[model samples]
Target: MLCYRKHSLFTKKYHIFKYDNEIHLGETTTKIKYTINLTPQTMIDWSINHQTKQLNGFWLIWKKQQKFFLMDATTCNLFKQTLNGIVTYGKHQILYEPIQSLLHSSFGSLVKMKYLNSRDSYMCKTIQKSLQYTDDDFYYQIEILQSLNHTNILKLKEVYNSNKNYHFVFDFPEGGSLADLIKTKQLQFKEVQLIIRQLISTISFIHSKGYVHRNLKPEHIFFKESNNLESLLISEFELGCRLVDFQNKHPNCRVHGYTAPEIKSKIFTQKCDVFSCGVILYKILTRKDLFDHESITYDEKMMLHLINQSDIDPQYQNLLRKMLQFNPELRATADQCLTIIDAILERTPTFSNFLDRFNLDIIYLIYL
Candidate 1:
């Protein structure tokens, strides 16, 4: 129920009604007026925003362009609480019902879901927390995810806990993982540049906050929309941790080719992440897995030879070499790589046009 109304002149007060499976936002049940079908299954994107005259605003967009706004924080908060209650305890209480199982492993499965009311798709990762996670470990993970508020990093929207498993809800990238795209598309040079720049910038942000994403690979890199490389996102945080200024030693995580060589000796740091990014860059440019050979194994010499033979610009190759250096101390840092990438892009004549089309810094750039 709304205590504040946008049109106060009307004597009828605004109200919200929730049935067993649907939610209604209008004046009354007998005489209803709503922006759209208000149900948990409808695909609606909503947010709270600042408004003029010392009021907070709530806005909703659904079915593409249709929008609704309520210029009061109290109303929005109340509405959120109401929806949460229905989602948590209603008859069909599974707010995000699983639509498909995307992946399965010994630990758990990653399931694609559709929110019952809004119909927006989401990816839900179920973790068997009881087997390996303590109470502190669970809460600590939630805290870390909450703290990491970045555009490129996957955002954790909701978390649910059962007796044996923990369910985490994240925005689903319809475009799928970088690995999927690499299997099909041979990316152009400018596309490679755009992807790598965003990847390094995100890594730099994560390092600045004293954390390291131990698992940084093509499979974990996702595109928000299909065929839209500029909408890139990095996810899968099961191995990420805070470094506390490199004062503590964290456990090593190994992915065949993306893992830094130094990690093989249990010496891991922020530089390891940079090496992973470099591996991804190589994969994007060459459309080949760096070390995934069945019969013929790739030694460092062979790998270097392959990189040299690739068609990417020499500048990127040189940067990749620096990033994939065996010595941790000699590896380029995220900031340093970002600087080189920026310089390379700036030197290009088409750089300005590129920015106008694909700059992630401009928050309003949308896919046509």
Candidate 2:
């Protein structure tokens, strides 16, 4: 790729080329002839500015520590093309080591994949390519994942499409999904609170961005560390839909009980997401699926018994009531729920006393 720097008299040329399948940039001048390797992680930002609808040269901000490259139109296009095919198949194998182990294997397989050159590991989600999934669908999910930037949300590093499958490289949460945790042991009240707080905060962010995560069950929630329940991260956005796109039409709810009842009418909104969170909170607290036993028509008496169970803390019970309100308008907004939770936590001193009296053997979930 071609790059240039402005000198007092004229522009000095710099060149970027491939060496041993790795990209390199160096100045042409003999006095300062130097080359540096550039990888996918090195490219921080690349953009071509426009002024009043007119094209301008692109500024490529890449760094090992701190480096910049300015490329003209043709050079920028070439660099982009190189990046597009940088990790197609053969290069993907070269960059990332073989899959270490399987994390989940239901609809698709979630495997632990590590980098060849570094100790860092990531989860690779492999989904079989079928006619059911189109280019537009894949791109839309990519756009949504790229748009989200949050601490409690799983990060998508790269996407690879092979002949038979599509690979989504994601940050590996060592503790695994919340569902995994639930199947092993009952969580402390404080742990449940921490998970709910993080979930609501991230959900607030998602709603602000005009998107609703129709599915928010335990399987979609993960923890960043095995020992730290507070290090939670939410993942899986396949059922997510933009609010604007659904102004006139909406898809059916994918997660049966977790989604709000209004979704049956093909209506979805930010409130519906809040309702799903309410169901998750109920699940974590009671150690039971909210609608696991319900049929096409829910058992209203049983559902109410589960919701109004006396064992759940009164503060959470109150919050659940507002969140799980039958009418969408009566339901609490994520922001409102967050505020309520904050106040509840502040007033409840025992909220901080996690595992003070319970035996570690009784509460801890052994991964092995």
Candidate 3:
């Protein structure tokens, strides 16, 4: 929970609760933080660097005048940065960077640090050493991920192998993840289609490079800090494995809907990713899971029919059928899915679905 008690010189106050789609003004001493909700468009002008994981620049409105302040995570103190100097609320001299709050805790908690300089801000991801992977295996995986140069994949800057855990350094994104966004906003069709196209292309690139993403879903997908949808980055490559010399065990996907039917059988190919993407496509369009999130209970007789095709465009439904086919061989390959995505984008005139928009081109963008 975010907390702050107003101090002298800080007559005005604003507290921001961070999320993926939108940041909300949770509480303020003034009672009115913002007239309405805000996105990156509304936050066009700001002095703070978006990349800093700690509290950044934010805006608040009071007495018909707009005010801005930079947040200090250490003491929950707010400061206004101006051309002349900084106007602080509390006894603010100089604060050395401190370890801030944890960004995520479940999937191996990631701790974010407050940076004295904007460039010093970074994210630390620590994983427990498991029996499946040895020191050499972890290093090999990191090596593969480091070699992967793609805009859609998360960058691994440095890695440290310790006795108890493996630590990785990465640039922090301002926005959280697609999973975080979906919790609040019902994604529009056009937006979902665009995200789908980008992810499919990236997954296809991985397949072409002889690797399978083993896991592909909303939680793994992240957006850059500025809430730019196009800045989607897929992280968590520890589960990734090469197609040829596969060794690690398949991840448990019971909670996440993006697991393929063939995953349990241990007989799959690149099409497993197609199945996973298909699950995501169905979800964003309908906001309902193929199987219940709480339990896998589903009426087998009406599985496909339950998808509510009437609300979705026909092309999406058709694509879902191909990708979600129970037979692995019958499912669409990465290239085939890419073709369908291209056709859909070409047909829909209004949507700016830049189908082949992955920059890293005709010869680019793959993940671990």
- CA-lDDT, candidates in order: 0.71, 0.71, 0.63
Identify the superior model by lDDT, candidate 2 or candidate 3. Answer: 2
Q: What is the TM-score of each candidate against the true structure?
A: 0.68, 0.69, 0.63
For TM-score, candidate 1 versus 2, the one ahead is 2
10 residues in a row with least lDDT, candidate 2: 50-59
Decoy 2 TM-score against native:
0.69
Over 4 Å off, model 2:
1-14, 17-94, 97-107, 247-253, 293-297, 350-368
Q: Which segments of model 3 are wrong by more than 4 Å?
A: 1-107, 115-120, 247-256, 294-301, 308-310, 350-368
Among the numbered candidates, top TM-score falls to 2
lDDT agreement of model 2 with the native: 0.71
Best of the two (1, 3) by TM-score: 1
The residue-by-residue lDDT of candidate 1 on 293-319, one tens digit each, is 343233678778878888778889899
RMSD of 1: 14.0
lDDT of 3: 0.63
Per-candidate Cα RMSD to the true structure, in Å, reads: 14.0, 12.0, 18.8
For model 2, what is the alpha-carbon lDDT of residue 188? 82
